[model samples]
Target: MWGGCWPAGPLRRSAFTRRLSVPISAPEALLTVRGLEAGYGKIGVLHGVDLHIAAGEVVTLLGPNGAGKTSLLRALSGLLPWSGGSARFGGLELRGVGPREAAQAGLVHVIEGHRVFTQISVTDNLLLAGYDLPRAERMARVEEALSFFPEIAAKRHEKGGALSGGQQQMLAVAQGLVRRPRLLMLDEPSAGLSPVLVDRVLNVVRELQARGTAVLLVEQLIEKALGAADRVYALAQGRIVLEAATSEADLPRRLERAYFGDDAVSPLEA
Candidate 1:
């Protein structure tokens, strides 16, 4: 049977910090998914997804709009119904779990679009994310999240709606960290932000990885995603058409292949 909640213990720590003792050895896989399928109603979006991420790896999922990237993430986070497949994190089955249970399972999905409570104070919004956690631990995690985004920290007393778009986006991410999840899944984090704010958000993601949190990021900025991720998966029409590594030097060609297949001809050719 699957575990009842997302994390089995208190404020689940990032697995990245645990392997520092054996620096020479490779980190173990923290999450794995196979043959995953899900959708809204009868229209299937994800058609047998397969993926895995090591304890400290930054794996980005790239795709055009409506290619099922968000659907796949929702399935992983238990926000959507799964038709079939296995999702395992740290050896636990996540087939029928709910989103809250997934969060406790150390797999936190920071949804796209700022979903902060409009009427609530910034601190209060964060408090809601960790209401299940003990007070002291919750406080600690909130502080840690605030440290990553000084803009949010300064506006902790302000209502969520009062913050700028960039600041609200920062809060959305901060709210996800109170549980101290091992795998942080982000969707279109750079959407609607200025280039400078986008860099700030990406920097936070890098810091999270540095602190040993595995990241499954869905970003549109090809260069930024490639720069931050060790491996990249590009989904086209509900399928992963290509995957490549940053060290491969032929990354441009790889991306081209993923975006437009080799057989695709230029307009002039037609």
Candidate 2:
């Protein structure tokens, strides 16, 4: 996020990390997934999966492509039906739940593509997400979400499709924020973003955690993910292969070693 091109080495501490006085630690699970299995008909993506995200924590899911990271989010958000196991967000079980029900229950999934009402204005897009609320409360929520994404706030009157990709991505997150999620699941939130905008968006993730929203992130930017993660779970071939605290002395090394059986593969190379 500095002025120059992104550094080639592993991600270093940011000013955001230093600003916090206390370290975030693991808490009781706000979301609990056990033996989760999901896939298209006759195909399976998650295999006996087990994962948890504590209240107000940021947990990142990492892995190479086709590792079922997106599938995990989809399953949790109730976009895909589950074959076995349960995912509990607070007291509600996700199995058999619909996408709108999941969101209403405070489980918001901002999927990878940053889907929005392209033909509508940015403000209208956010308003659509809060349609269940009264107009007065809806406007308040919209304003609060805009505060987190000032770029979109500046273009509030423009069509959602007119914004650049990064701005649209921000608007997608802002839409989710208006829901005041108990657990926010993001799939590749930084994909295709410029380095600076990537930094900005990830900063919002960290900030959201500080403000008491638990986050479940699936990211390809391993270093950036680790830098902001409280705990991390790495998936490979549809199963969780590695789990560690972000504070581990050699996290990237251990993650790669767990994935490839070679300590030589730094996350920077991924």
User: Candidate 1: what lDDT?
Assistant: 0.79
Rate residue 104 of model 2 by lDDT. 95
Candidate 2 lDDT, tens digit per residue, 139-238? 9999999999889999999999999999999999999999999889988889889989999999999899989999998887777888888888877667
lDDT of 2 at 126: 97
Best candidate, TM-score: 2
RMSD of 1: 11.3
In order, candidate lDDTs are 0.79, 0.83
Measured with C-alpha atoms, the lDDT of residue 84 in candidate 2 is 95
Backbone atom clashes (below 3 Å) for every candidate: 5, 0
Deviation of model 2 at 266, angstroms: 2.1
Off by over 4 Å in 1: 1-27, 263-270
Task: Write down the lDDT that model 2 would get.
Answer: 0.83
Worst 10 residues of 2 by lDDT: 12-21
Per-residue lDDT of candidate 1, residues 42-101 (tens digit) = 999987777778997899887666778899899989899999889888977988999988
